[model samples]
Target: MNEESNSKGIAMDLLQHFEDILESDPLIDELGFIHPSQFDLLNEESGISCNSFDEANCQSTDKILSEQSSKQENVYFWNKDHKLGISTHILLPLYKDAKHSFLTALKRYKTCSNQSNKDGDCLPASSSCDLESLLMRHSRSLLLLSCDFMTAWNSRKLVVSKKKQHSMFLNELILSGLVLSYSPKSEQAWNHRRWVIKSISAISSNLKDILEKESELVEKIAERSKMNYRAWNHRCWLISYMTREQVIDELKKSRSWAELHVADNCCFHYRSQLMLKIMKDSSCLVETVSFSHMVDIDKAWKDELDWNGTLIKRYVGREALWLYRRFISSCWINHFLTDSGDASHHFKESITNYHDFGTFLKKELCLIDYCSTVVDNEFGDFEAQAMHSASYLLWLKVKVPKPLENELLEKMRVIELKTLVEKSYPERSSLFNYFMS
Candidate 1:
């Protein structure tokens, strides 16, 4: 019983200490869990005894604050500058403390709510605010330990919704972001951020800045953690809140990152989402769009097509680039070809009528033929390249206007498409045959 009591005391003390550290330094943006031995080694190297922080707890507040400021200059215990490090030794204890405190507060809040409902009168304003503050504080630590704690998350939503303060909503963003600092892929954390954004949007006019920062956060997180779908998904979701100019700027800004990471489809998917937003905005315009604006949007689409082709050739065998092309091409056909008015077709061959469509088909066929005949090395990247090209052409044939199908098939007949596909990807031959028939 003594050991259990000591453990509970230590755990709560650690949890309280962590909370204090956060309160003192709210700028802590990154979190890492280091083994306790590492903390000991750092302390030993610095000629400070271990357990110094524990001892400082009993000191006068002034002394503890002075020591904390002093400690900030060193690599630091618990926190340094903009990052927080937690020792593995205390994680279990801290988690238990946090979970216990959270559940206790949550139970109390719910019971009070039930009583208020039963009595048909609201709780006193002071009492309600106190319970909410208690619940929020406890849940913050609990979620840091276990991000998927659904009830804890839902409780926060309940509290934040009732208060509806803009600053409180932003605090929710910070809390969710902290959870993301450790767990970049936490669906609940990401969802909480989206909820906060939506709840705050009704009263917040500075959403453009918020959306920009959210996008930057995703990119920063993505840099550290590769291929994070949730991060990219969050970025894509920000598109809905962006203006048309912001959407275009994002597309241009991602160009360099996309070039550096030819294989990461998430960034490309983000680009595609931006492009789709542009298309949707153009289609749903409240007034007639200017000819110059239409030309600018058209140039943007053509530029994307050209850029994708460059990457395909430069980074051969990249299926992601090829898949992105499929989406872009289909959108081009649907928007520029079938949906364009007669005037659009007349300007610089811009509307891309059947004539411009024919030019596109020829360019694509030339591309596939060139890819299929590429010289190879032992890596067989060329083989994969040929496979992608064959499949892409075959896929494109089906997606083309029905009148062009026979023309595409006739053009393909001269290229030995079956033999080209069979050499690298025989499984898709049946698909080709299906399309051919």
Candidate 2:
């Protein structure tokens, strides 16, 4: 044989010898893993003879297969002292199995550093597919593989590979605690998982994607908890990572859904807080429909606000009152600005006429006040604090404008007087007085 062919044959014989040793070792029956480094020592020291094999040209699948089957018998032998060995000729099938074994082994091996080494199996169907597409298709599966039981313990510990560590940590956490467990028993695996999730850097785009996924996870958590407070708390924390505007919009939608389904005052109290958060964040950002729907909740609710001790009673009332207060505050300010400038004519058509502020406030404002007081008395909760603050500021601003002050004060007095009369008179009788006043 040529000298090159002779060297290759020797390499193949040494590989076969390492495999034979693994098969003969009694540990393979129980542990199911063999250290690669141990295989390296057998290659250097065994001095096995070979007639036909090439170490550099690992092109013959038949040869690789013959070698693999011969070595398969010795799977559990360990030679930790030998430097890690690079296999010369690997059969495709055996290579895949070895990758899986390595992944499994690394899970048990603490501090395995070369996680990407096992990823050779995860490459494309052929040589043409790029790395990005390969990862996209197999990220989750590969992540699971890398974090398999006992794999981390057996593999070379990699401290420098941040990306691999991230994958490992994520998989560990997900399988540990983020998922619903049938057994109420907590595991160290779960605590470690949470640590990894928390340690994820906020600046990373991948972390952002994970944060989005976390919303779905929180929803799942809520399902497991039956809409419990702990689930809601986690949901809120996840939402906090998103933009304020988006978070509030999502919260508003969630609150509406919550109000529709949840009948407890405490739950409604939570919804009210969510609404109040949106208003406090930026009242102007609130949509007209959400705004109008809130203020006119009874109108939206069709007198459901008056029902006896319903959770909706208190929450709807508070929301309506808050909306009314905010609407008037906005209106008063707009009108005061118009009256101060050349734009005073805009109100001549709407204000003095009962169609604008006069009749609207007479009916709506009274209802809002009654509901506000009902919320205070029944649930002892107040959502009008922001609106109240806005109104207080507006009140101070309009003190110097006599016409604006007089008009708003008169409207306020009428609302109060009508509310008092409603408490004393029959419903229809109060309606007649409300229409007359």
- Model 1 alpha-carbon drift over 4 Å, by segment: 41-77, 113-128, 339-355, 406-418, 427-434
Give all TM-scores, in the order shown: 0.86, 0.32
* Candidate number of the best lDDT: 1
RMSD of each: 5.7, 19.6
Residue 429, candidate 2: how far off, in angstroms? 23
lDDT digits (tens) for residues 1-437 of candidate 1 = 66567657756777787777777777778777776447656556656554454432111121122123332222223565567777664577788889999999999999999988898646787988788888998998889889999999999999889878998998888888988999999999999999999898888766887888898899888988899999999899888888998998899889999999888999999999999899788766614676567778888888998999989989989999999999999988777766444233344254443236666777788888888875866767888899889888878877988876777777777688888878757776666667777
Span of 10 residues, lowest total lDDT, candidate 1 = 57-66
Candidate 1 Cα RMSD after full superposition onto the native fold (Å): 5.7
Question: What does the lDDT read for residue 377 in candidate 1?
Answer: 69
